[model samples]
Each structure stands twice: as C-alpha cells, then as structure tokens.
Target: MFLTGEMLIGQQSVTGSSAPISAINPATGERLEPVYLGGSEAEVERAATLAWQAFDAFRETTLSQRAEFLNAIAIEIEALGDVLVERIIAETGLPRARVEGERARTCMQLRLFAEVVSRGDWLDVRVEPALPDRQPLPRLDMRLRQIPLGPVAVFGASNFPLAFSVAGGDTASALASGCPVIVKAHSSHPGTSELVGRAVQKAAAQCSMPEGVFSVLFGSGREVGAKLVAHKFIKAVGFTGSFSGGTALMNIAQARKEPIPVYAEMSSSNPVFLLQGALSTRSAALAETFVTTLNNCAGQFCTSPGLLIAEKGALLSSFVESASAFMNESSTNTMLTPGIYEAYEKGLSLLNDNPNVRRLAQAKESDLPNQCRGSLFSVGAKDFIQDESLHEEVFGSAAIIVECDNFEEMVLVAESLEGQLTATIQADESDLGVAKHLMPTLERKAGRLLVNGWPPGLEVNHATVHGGPFPATSDSRTTSVGSAAITRFLRPVCYQSVPDMLLPDALQQSNPLMLKRLYNGDWEV
Candidate 1:
C-alpha cells in the first residue's frame, strides 16, 4: 500500500482533517502519492498528547521487553529486505548492490542497538560511597545513569533511505533509549520510507508497544518540517542533510522557549593531502585510488574526498593525468535522486565557469537510460586558496586537483579546509617524517584521519567517529553511524541520596542490568 501524507497514530494512518501535499519519485520524476498535511494548532496538540500518553508506559517498560521489541523490528525489517531493496532502487536509482548493502547496514544497525539493549548495560550506572572517617569528610553516595529525553523528531535523509530513514538509526536508537520517535519522511524516497514504516508498525504490534510510541508523518512542504521542529513536544531532533537545511532546523529548535538538542550531520568536503615523496614513488597507485575515491557511488558519499592537494611538479601532473583518464573511462551513472542530480550539475557548473578552474577531463553522454556523465576539474593551489566557492561540496563523480608548489603550500591548503568527516594522507617513508607535522594539522581539520587509505568504507565500531565539526556535522562530539550512536539518544541523570531499593537497576550493586561498565577502576559485567 502506498503511504499517503497522514499522521500514523497507533496502528492506523489517520488523515488530518485538512489539505495535503504530494511526494514524488525523483528517478522517474513522477508524483507517487499525496500525504495529508498536518492540521494547525489543535492537531499539533493532539499529536503531542498521544506521544505523552505513550511515553508514560513505554519509558517504564522493562529493558528486556524493550529488547524484544527492537529485536522484533530487526527481524521484520529483514523479512521485508527484498521489497525494501526494490522500492529503494526504483525511487532513488541506486544500484541493486548498493541498495542491498544499505539494507544490510540498516538491519545491522537495528540488531546492534537491540543487542545493546538486550545486554541492558548501556544504561550502566556508577556509584561511589563516602566514609565519614575519611579526611574528605562524610559524603552521600553519588550515582550516575542514562535516561531518555522524551519524544524525538527524526528528519529522514534522502541519500541512504533505509539506513537513515524510518526504522533507521535515529528511530531505532531513540526507541532503544525509551524515547518515542516522529519521523519526517524525505520526499525523494517516501515510498521506501513507508515500506519500512510498515515493518516498524508490525514490530510494535507484535511486541505490544504503546499506541503513540512511534509515529511516521509525511508531507512535502517546508512548513510541515518547520512546525515539527518547533513543536513543544519534541525534546530533541536528529538530522542528516545539507548545511542549509540542518542549520535552519537548529535555529528553530534554539528559538524554542526551552531549547532542545539538535543533532545534525551536515555537509562536508573531505580533503586528501598527497605528500611529494609519496606522489613521486607511487603516482600510478595513488592515481587509481584517487579515481576510486572520487567516483565511488558517483561520489555521493559524505566522506568523498572532494579536494586533493598535491605538490606541484611532474609527479603531480602524472597523477592528475591518470586520475582524469580513469574518471573519463568510468561508466556514466544515475544519481540517488533528481534533486541531487540538479544540485550536482549546478555545483559542477559553478566550479567549471570559475576563471581560476580548468577542466582536466570530461565524460561523454552514454545511451544508458537515466545515466548522466561527469567531468573532472583542477586549479592551482594559489587560485584554490583564493576562491571560497572552490571549497564547497560538489556531490557527484568529480574531484578537484590542486597543484601546490611545495610542502609549505600543501600545509597552507590543509589549513584552509573547513571541518570535514575525514582527511586522508597519502605518504611514503620519507613523507612520514613530514607527516608528524601534517597529521596533527589534519586531525584538527577533520574528525577521522586516514593514512594511505580511502575513507568511504565506514566501520561501525567503537573507534569510528562518523561525525565531524560544523559542516561535517553540527557537533563533533557525537557520531551517527556506529555503536557510539547510542550517545545521541541518551542523557545522564544522577540519583542523589536515594536508597539502594529505590536506585535504578542499572545502578544497583547487584548489577541487574549486566552491561559492561567501569566499577572500582576495573571492567565489570
């Protein structure tokens, strides 16, 4: 069933008693369906009231029960994997392999959070008792525990519909944290969103969750999103999108009478610095890797290295020539959505028309349906540094080769970068000597640091930081792609002078939660 723009309350899609808007499929450039626009003042209040009702019981539910619900959700998502993949391919024009991988990632993310909940230890609480005889004097027992922050608003991302949309990390993590979620479906892939939404609803029913514990709202208007962010019931927000859109929501959240946290993973122009020694020794290998990095997934990844700073010389010229040739020979590709396609063209046009920029190679249009070719551009390091627009992200199979005169010029270019999700250093033995100087500078400019490697394959582990500063993400301290994602859904709450019986299971000495924790300066389980 096509999911219309209606407020999902309990297990039903209740159309708001008002006008609505249509959600389109970008691949076909067709109107798939219309979603009911949410009603004004009274409707917002009603939605909030339902969420509050659900929260009271949902928050109090046992962790084991919550785990069952989350696990069920994961299973349901897996069962519908094929259906989800097909819809995603049709709506977003993503290759089948790519869609399958995203589906796996989505299911993995859900199961990961479920395991985190099943262990019941992510909420690990710590306690320290004070002795009256001690020199520090008698003190009350201090305890720490993580608690949910009420209802959350999740903005669906257009790029990775399954992994970042309804039933995605935001919804799974929030639900795992005992917080209800309201997802604003991305217009680009609403059909895929609805399929996943149905799976979530199925899981909620099987696990007997509260009626309003999760709601999926659909609309195509800016006002719909503006109202959702401004709603008093939304205690927090999760966004993954462009800088302008993310920042706009943040401003609205801040303007609230009582401000809420808005976790927005914005845009990034991840940079790569190729040292002279490395470029001189491994020009061909570096060129191939650079081509793969820039053209991977049509360069739609957030960590795509948009800028390349190489020392000015014959080595640099060779690297540029090989990379340009590789991109030209690569197949033309379809974008995730038409909106993205338009943006990519516009960004490319802007860079191409700039007087300082020069086209290195261009792809010829192919007969393949829905496939658009891409081109490569370059400019001198001095010119790149002087032009602010050169730094913007051009989301497609494109790369900018910046030729630098020497190590000093390379460092200057590195220093000029805005916050990024990652920055890679292609260095050899001799380059390592200089790397000591460049690594620190690069670390300050990005969240993740790579050496002689690519940044596209994100590992969802404890050490991975999928977020960065400013344009890379609104907050560098949190990540949205790994187990660390739990941090986004949790806030610490201290239990002061409460009796052991009154203390949360997470904090009790008996260790009922059985989660990994630090106790008396040692790991405990």
Candidate 2:
C-alpha cells in the first residue's frame, strides 16, 4: 500500500505546493509511492509559528493529560501492527520479522515514555529547605526543575524507519516532554514515514492536541533539511545517520545565530576483542557467533562489530576458517536499500584494493541482484593499527580480522581505537585479569561495554546508550535510544521566590505532579 505526505499542522493534514518524491522498495527495487515534499521556507516558518503557538498551551498541560496523550499514541502505534510493519519492510527492503521487531520497539519506546511521564518525576525537580541556624543562613528555599525546550527538529534515519523516524524516540521523547516536533522524513522511506506520521496525527487529534504539536516534512534534497535546522524557531535537533550527514546538520545547528544542541548519533566501528584463552576454549562457538554477528541484518546495524581483534594462534585461525565457511553457506542476503547495496559494493572494492588487506572470504557470485552476501578480511595487528583508513566504518556485512601477536598487541589495538558505541569482550574467568586492565582504556574509548556478545541488538531500557564520542555520536552526554533520550528534549530551570501557585508543577512545594526525583542526594519515589 502506498502512502502520501500531507502536512500535519494544527492536528490536521494540509497539502502544499511542493512536488512528490518517489519512495522505493529496496528489496525489489520498485517504486512504492510518491510522497509530497515540503513547500518553501515560508511553509516551514508557518509550521514553526504554529508550534510556538501550540507550545504556549501544550507546555502548561497537566501531567495526567500529557500521560494520556502519550499513552494514546502508543496504543495507536500498536493498533497499526502488521500494516505498518509490512509497509516498512516494503519501503526499506528489511525483512518482515525485523520490521515487526522495530515496530514493537517503537511502540514500547512510546509506552515507556508514557510511563515515565506518568510518574512525573523525570522532570527531576529538587527542593532544599532553608535553614536559619546555619552559619551562612539560607534566606530562601531552593528548587530545580526541568522544562521543555520548545520546538524540536527530528531527522529520520534511512536504516531505522520506525525506530528513528516520525514516531521514533525523538518524537516520543519530545511529545512526552511537551515539546512540539517537526520531522524531516528520510527520502529513502518516505512512504513508511507518511503512514507513521498519520498515526501520530491520529493520536494527537484523539488527545485534543494542538495542530502544531506535530508536523512531518518530506524533501528529496538537502536544502529542505538545512532550512529546517537553520530555522531560529527550532530549539534542538535529533538525528541518526551517517557520520558525514549528522556532522553536516550539527555544523548547521552550531552556525545558527542562537546555537542549538543537535543530538546526532553518527557512525561507529563497534570493535570485538576475542581473547586467546576464550578462542582456545570454544573456538567453534565463537566462530558461529561471529558469523551471526556479521550477517545479522546484513551487518547494517550501527553497532555491528566491524573490527575483530584476536590473538595470533591456531584457535583464532580455526575460528576464522569456520566463520568464513558459515557465511558462504548462508543464502539469505538482501540489503535495506539500493543505496546501502551500492555502498556495500564500493566498501568491498576498496578493501580488496588495499595492499595490506587480504580478502579472507569473498562471495562466490558478483552478478547476483540483491542476493549479494557479506565478505571477510584479515590483516596483521601492525597493519590494522597503523592504517587509519582501517578504523573507518564500512556500514555493511563485512568484518575485519586483526591478528594480534600477544595480549600487549591487543591492548595497543584497543587503545588505538577511536570513540565507539560499544566494545565487546569475549573471554572467560582467566581473561578477567586482562579485561580489568583493559576496562579503563575501553571505558575511555567507548560509550557502552559488552561482554561475550555482539552490539547490534539494542535494548530500549534505561541503561541503553546508542551513542558515543565524536564519530560514534556528535555528543557523548546524549543518546538517541532509551529512556535517557528524554534528556535531549529538556533543560533545567530554577525558580526562586516565586509564589507556590505561580511556580511550575515540577517546582511547587505541594508536588502536585508527584513525579520521581532525587531529593537531598536520595531517590524519592
């Protein structure tokens, strides 16, 4: 089924003068539908004005009312179910199961934020009573509260249409925080984004939300996206895509007269370290896991293990052989988009041409359509660490094996790594000694640390951090996935000497919202 774009403003769908952009099915390379691109700069300004108008009232919405709105959005998303999943699969060329999983994750994230808002304390307000007996007598009570940052600009990611697009984390968190959203749909899967945008509008209308509370813009060119970020009305931005693309948006945000925070999750080479002892213990098991990790979703995941560090030994050799054999035997190979397919082809060609890199395994066929499979490459630790190009992410079903001469070489390789989303360690009890020594260095290099597992499957919980430093993410303190994501949509504000009734719900002494908070260094329920 094809879905077309209709501007969602003031809780309604409005047409614009912008032409249509074709949304293609990556799996079959067929055009699914043409979605309407957004109109000129004036339209964007109008939308922003609407959002600013909505924010005046929406920000004052009671916690219970906001909770109901968010919960309704979650329910609407769940109700879409298979229809939404199939559309995502058809548009993005992802498998049905993967799309369904993302849909569930998207719904879960919405519901999670709903629950978080329901509790009210995510605002994390604190109150300290004044003391007259102290040497430096406190004259007044002190309170801290978190407030919405006004309109948010969200850029949809090509890889995760459901999880990072219209109804994705950015929208969910922003709405939950009472900030209006204007999403710039990814050109690759505009159809899916349109459908999801409809769901968001449905939820908004059902909850009596303002028309400007949510808006979705479609554009084939970068100009529209640039204009959205550069707009003065936009208070912040949320993005998930390639390092170059995210960085470009960040540059635009930074260049603004009044700079805004751009929480952009860029690229990362999630490295996997396999200790010699673990390899000796369960080389076959390790090989099977490696194959699964490399081939999972055709290795398109941002957290996919792109670099594998292993000690030079017979076990490591056997693991590589088994992994290559398994990958060759696996028949399932379809990319999410033609752009991804082309990128994969170019990355493989570049690796093949590298003098220091050896193609450990190549797919048997090259002329195949979307049936193209992943490949494996190996290089000595000296070469892998010395070549800066080797550290860059290829964004495909390819793994680079770096053979280290000893534990020290492994440590050196680990130390040499740039910022990463995750760094995995496959080891047993004996390897803990080395892990202990490496943990400090790894902690400095990565945002998340994993043990005996891969990093592709991200959990949408409180602890999950889908971000890292620099290349992994534009900022280290923010994440694009998980409950912590709400932080990006909010900023703290302190009110002093304000009347109890005049203060925000978060700062009122009555604690009318009853939200959770950290009170005097203690967690208050």
Candidate 3:
C-alpha cells in the first residue's frame, strides 16, 4: 500500500483544493513524505451528501451482516501489518512496542463491537399486544426499539493514532449501531490516517457495504471540522481532543436549526487519593508504582494520574522522598508533536512561577527535540482549594501533591476538585472507614472510581466506562469505549397502532432475531 495524499470520499480518491499539510517526525524533527492536501466546504458537502444517501439502506442491514462488516474491518486493519506500524511510529514518535500494543487494542475493540452487534442486545426491543377489553377503552398495539441516529462526524485524536484515529472506537461503535461516519483526520498523523482509512474503505467494499458507509477528510485548520459539524445531514458527533476544540464543536452543533448531540471527550486531570494506612505500610512500593504510572508514554494518556492528595506527616514525607528518587531516575521521552511539547513547557513554567507551588523533583534534561521530562510539585491543601489553575490538565508527565493537615482537609481537597475520568484510592483493610467516607465525593466527581489500582490501563470490555461528567465528556450518560458506546449513536423510537407486517424485524410479533425483549410488560428470552 502506498500513500497518495488524497481524501477518501465515498469510493472516490479526490485531490483537495485547500492548503496542504504534512506529518513531521517528532523524535528527529524531520519532515515525512507525501504532504496531504486539506479539504474545504465543497468536500464536506460531497461526503455528507453521500452519507445521507446511504443511511436508510445501511441502517436496515441484518444483524449478522453488520456484525460481519465490523469483523471484516478488524481483519483488514490487521492485514495492513508492518506498513501500518512503521508509519504510526514515524508520525507520532511513539515506541514500536507501544504502537504494536495500541494496534492490537484497536483490533480487539473492533472485534468486541462485532460480537456485541451479533448478540442484538443493543436494539433494546419491546412489544405490547393490543388489549380489546370491555372494562375500558381498547388500547392500540405499541412496540418500541432503539434505532441509529443519522450520520455521525468523528474527530481523531493526536495521542493514540491507531486506537483513536480514523477507525477508532467512535467509528467502530457508530458503524456497529448502523450510522454512516465521516472522519476529520488529525493533522499531526496524516499518513497514518490515510493508511487506516484505505483499510476501512477496502473492508466496506469486500463486505458489500454501501459505497458511502465511511469516508475520511483532511483539514489543517478549523474550517473543515466546523463545516462537517454544522452540516444539516450530520446528526451527531464523536470527538476526542482539547477542551477548546470539544466545546467549539458542541457550540456549533447546538446552534444548528435541528440541534444534534456531541459526545466530545475533552480534558481530565485524573486524581489519585493516598490513604494513611496504605501509605504507612507500602510507601516505597506505592511511590515506585505512582512514578511508573505517571511516566508511562510520557503521561500522554487522558486518564493519567495528575493530582495526589495525602495528609501531612512523616509517612507522607517518606512517600515523597521515595517518589522523588524515582522521578530523578526517570528517562526523558519524545512527545507526540512539536506543538504538544511547547504547550507542556509552558505549563511547567506556570507552576515554576507560582508562589504557593514548590518543585519537588524533576528528571534530567535532554538536548533532543520534543522531549518530555517527568516532574513533581507540591502545594498546601488550602492553596490548592483556592487556586483553580491547579485543577487544569497539563497533558504531559507532571503531577501535583496536595499536603493536607488532617483527614478533614483531605476530604475538602477531593470536594474542591473538578470532574475527572477516574479517581483512585490506595487503601488497606484498616483504611476502609476513610475510603468509605470519600466514596460519595469521588462518585460525584469522577466517572470511574478505582480501589487499589492505577487509571492508565483502560480495558475494552462490557463494564468499562471511558467517560465522565462535564469536561471529561459532553454527556455523562454515555461512554466512548466498551460495548455501551453503541448507545451514544442510538435513539429510541416507538410505533403506535402499526400493523405487524409493517413493523421492523426486532419489533415483530414472531421475535425473529431471538433477542431478549420486553413483551406485554414481561421479559421474554
């Protein structure tokens, strides 16, 4: 497979008319080959028009057929092989092992959604027979089932090029739920996005899917994305990026004459709470694990632990000493892009200039371009509570420790924090009372509450939730990962007094799909 620097718009490889964008190797600061041309409103119109045309036919596809299409996408991605791996490494400067792991995760999630589709649980079908009784006015027959919202617009993320890019979770879940997709590829990894986009295009062809089922667009600035979000045919959106980008999309979607839902995952400073009992017994071990989690992938993950809260004492001092030792030994890593590296440096400077914040430890400096050195800082609990700047995400490997005077202050710190993707508690059996006290506050602040675990290792399973309240995600009721993610692209519709033959397969009287459904106020398997 070769890179062509063309946009895939419904089985057509069209050249763009806007300014071209190229990928640069962040590790060595070298330009990559084959610059990709940017798209304009005309391209957006073409893609959205095709997507709307294919929606009715694609949404009516059988369960087995749609599931097979998803599985075919996974197979096609795996077939890309080393070509995909090398391109991803060059584009994002991530290590080969990490890239390989992300590729596996990407395929696993696609297959997982395939299985979810085959099970037919996402339909949530229900039926109620007509009652022609004489006691009261006769009731008409009514049936209900969830249906896919129209076309969707997905914005790729810069950090995870494979698992969260052109054919990532948003695309997989949206397709599984029977919605056509139009992707706005991230500018930082155009070559990688093109490779994956071609694979998806091939899969649609091999599976005999609609021609306009999926399309990929490239844009260097906000023009293409804004046009896609504001288009009348795009019924919903799935975004993963900065707060400014996500909020901008949300505002555009809401301003439309027919407003749409934007499931945008923006920012999170996933906080970790260190309890007294666990810290006293395993301070050294806990410090080692904390630093390890903090430095993983240069702390580029959305779920990275950015804030730590603990009571002030010798136990806390020992934990700090051990953590500082590990931080000093940590190696510098190349970031995803030059712009990301610059933003990280500016964030460090802000903390350095603050009067209440004191630097605790920092890794050795490196002369390499786009390098990130792990850093740790500390501030009093009162200062953290009063300063809102301490709660913002830095998007790199930097963490803050809030030293509290007592348990009450620790609770107050947790209460003062903003919404997060995760909140972790390091506790022992004796610390259950303290952990119990903090549970309600954490439950309100974070989407996923962890006991004795880190937050970076996200699992692609049924029960896992990769979303949260407010800035963590635009809508708290939905998740952007796991089996439940399909619900984000679906809406319930009810049929009243419709004849049996005129109903959809899932809502028919014969129960053709063998799905677990609510029948006449009773559950039937």
Candidate 4:
C-alpha cells in the first residue's frame, strides 16, 4: 500500500483535478503531505456507477467469501501496524496509546462483523409451507429473507479516525451487508484515510472481490459529497458527523428521484440524572467519576455526559464542590482540530453569557492553541425547561447542571430534554420508585439507557446501539454500530410460490448454511 494522494476507484488510481487538500496536524497546526487533489462530481459519478455495476455480483457472494474478505481487511490493516497508529496520532491530535487502541478496535470490529457474516443470522430467513386444503383458501408457499440495498456512500468521521473513518463501522457494516461502499475521506485526516483505504483495496483484491467493491475519495468542498448523496445509483448513506452535515445528506437522499435511506449518527448532549438516594449515598464518588468521564478525549465522544439533572440539596452542593475541585486542577488538553476548538469556545461563551446560568467551575488557563479548558455551568430547572438553547450539544468538555426543587421538578426537567444517544440514571433501592416512573419518558428520549454509570465509551457488539432519535441520528429505527448495524443497509424481501431450484440459498429448505430461521410458522433465532 502506498500514499499517493490518489483516489481508489474500481481498481483505478484517480488523481483529482480540483484544488489540492492536505492533512493537518491539529496539535502544531502544521500541514502534512501528500497533498490530495480535490475530488470532482465526475469522480463521484464514476465511483457510484462502478459501485452499482459491481453490486449485483458482490452482493451475490457466498457468506464465507464475504466473511473472508472482511477478515482480509483486518489483516491488511494490522499489517500496516505502527505506521497507521503514528499517522493517526499526528493527524487527529489524539495520544499514541489512544490511537493504538482505536486501530485495534477498528480491526476487532471488522473481524466481529466477519463472524456475523459466517453465522448467517443476518439473512433473517423465514419460511411458511403451503396449506393446499386450508379453510380460508390455500396459503401459498412464502419465504422471507434480507437482501443488500446496493451501493452505500459513507462519510468518514472526524472524531474516531479509524473506527469511524475509511474502514470504520459504517464502511465495515455496509460491506458486511453486501453493499459496495464509496467513502468521502474526512478532510482532517486524508493521510490516515488513504492508508486505511488502501488496506481495504488490497483486501478486496486479495480476496478476489470485484473492483469498485470499496472506493475512497478526497473532497475539498461539499459539492463532491453532496453529488455523491444525490446520485441516483447510491441506494443508501452512512454518516457520523454534525447535525447540519447529516441533515444535508438526508435531505439530498430524500429528494432524490428514488429516495434512499440515510443512517446518520449526529450530535448528542447525553443527560445524566442523579436521583436523591444515589446522590445522598456517594455524591463525592459520583462527582469524581463524572469529572473523569467528562474530561475523557476532552469530551469529544458522542456519548459523553453533557448535562446533569438533580434536585437541589446538601448532597447536590457537596457534589458541586467535588466537581469544582477537580475542574480547578484540570489541565487543558489539545482538541481534535482548530475548527472544533473555535466552536467549543463559542459554546462556552454561550453558557457564560446566558443570564439565567451560573458558572459552576472552570479550568485556570487555556495556554495553548487548540487546547480546550473544562467548564461547568448551572441553571434553575425553570430556566432549563424554558430555554431551548440549553438543550443544544456544546461538543466539548462542558456541561450544565439543572437544579430542580423536588421530584416533580426533576421529572419536568427530564421531560423537557430532546432525543439523545444515551440517558443515565444514578439510583439506589430507595429511588427505584421514581426511577421506574422516569423509565417511560427516558425510553422515548434516548436510544440507550444507563443505570449508575456515566455515558462515554460504547461497546461494539451484537446488542450495542450507537444511535438515537434526532438530532442524535437521522433515523432512530437503525443503529450505526455493532452487529445490528448491518440491518441499515439491508431490506427484507419475500419470495412466494418460487420453486426450490429458484429459491435464494438462505431461503432453501436444506438450509445449506445451517442457520436458525423461521420454518412452518415457528420462530427461530
């Protein structure tokens, strides 16, 4: 694999003819080579056309073949090893250890999806036998199975460069679901993107997969990406970014001549609820854990706890003191990029200027460029309930504590929140009654609920859901993480009165893959 700043398009190396784009080291504000040419609309068209051309063949591959191809991608990525990790660290301003861990996660998840493919459960095959002499007319033989939704356009993420980028969950899941993928590399990390993109290309070639099964492009402006989204051949989209960016893609997809699905994991101000009992028992410990989780990655994670709801009391005061002590001693950490740092500063300013909000804590200094200082704010429940601005996600190490007067006020505060990726409830046996009361509301407001723990790191597995209702994501029905993420790029298809000879393998009676499936109106795994 080589870094040529050339886009990979269906086994072809395309050097863009538009303006050049380069990766920048966020920590030092220095630009790094190779300077990638900005991709044009024509390139996007070419990729989409090729992907659609390849889809029929690619999607028809046996499960073992697709699984092996995914495994090959993981192996190729591992082969890159240190080069990949170091480049990601410099490009994203993340630490060496953190970058290494992310790279490992990237490979781990790819292999996980490979296992999912081999298992064949994703086909979701169901069958019903014909009842030729039934009372209400004979029920025709019918079989149901899932099929790929064709080519997918994935927008690499800025935060998790590897796990959510060129070969990230979006790409991995799309590929696993048998969709040819076209990735628009995030501008902040083109070098890293190129490396990983090349690894995928090598894997596809090595595994004898069709060309255009995976393509990566570099775009300097929104036109290149928007063009990809609006293309008629792209059947679905996968994105992880800002609300504006995600919605832009969603609107383009919806307005298309043939509308497509857009699975966009957007912003979230994950809220944490501290019940009276939990706060009374260990407010100090809770505060300590909150500060630590709040400061992780300088609070860039989508699941980072950004708001707190609690009733005003001595315990709440003690918690604030503990949090304040930690904030005072906290040192500024370098953020992902200058744009993000600037946005964070503006968010902090919004909190600082709000008349109803009081500053709860602030770090002493922001001594370096692109460094983010931790801050906390507090406001009365009445103001939080009234001001919609308070609900907007700040996207950094900043949070607001809503002080409610009583249980009813706390419930009101909970009811006022917008959709989130996660919502936490810190409770004990004594608070279970109120906690139970809050469940219905919380379930409606969030995709994942937590008990006695802050939301931060997400586990990538079969049951994990890294999605929520808007503005957390464009569609709440599908997740953008874990094994279930594959469903987003697949659609259920039913075959009726089709002979066994013509039936899709998964729907055939023999069950060649030996997968558990519904048979004769009985449920199966």
* Strongest candidate by TM-score: 3
Q: Model 1, 291-392: lDDT tens per residue?
A: 876766678888878888888788888888888887778777777776787888888889878988998886667664445466778899988888889988
By TM-score, rank the candidates, best first: 3, 4, 2, 1
- What residue pairs clash in candidate 2, if any at all? 10-211, 10-212, 11-211, 121-515, 121-516
Point to the candidate with the largest lDDT: 3
lDDT of 3 by residue, 160-257 (tens): 99888899999999999999999999999999999999999999998888988999999999999999999999999999999999999999999999
Give the number of colliding residue pairs in candidate 4: 0
Go through the candidates in order and give the C-alpha RMSD of each one to the true structure: 2.4, 1.9, 0.8, 1.3
Q: In candidate 1, how many Å is residue 454 off?
A: 1.7
The C-alpha lDDT values of all candidates are 0.79, 0.83, 0.94, 0.91
Predicted candidate 2 versus true structure: per-residue lDDT over 378-431, tens digit per residue: 999999889998998998888899999998999999988889999999998888
What's the number of clashes in each of the models? Answer: 2, 5, 0, 0
Rank order (by lDDT, best first):
3, 4, 2, 1
Give residue 335's lDDT in candidate 2 (0 to 100). Answer: 79
As for TM-score, the candidate ahead, 1 or 4, is: 4
Which 10 consecutive residues of model 3 have the lowest summed lDDT?
Answer: 132-141
Candidate that beats the other on lDDT, 1 or 3, i.e. the better one:
3
lDDT of 4 by residue, 1-525 (tens): 457999989788899999898887878889988999989988998999999999999999999999999999999999998888888888888988889888889998999999999998888888997889998798999999999999999999989999999999999999999999999999889989989988999899999998889899888878889999999889999999998999899999999999999999998999999998998899889898898888888898989889999999898999999998998788887899898999999999999999999998987686567988899999999999999999999998999999999988988988888889999999999999989999999899899999987787788988998888889998998888899999999999999999999998888888777888989867764
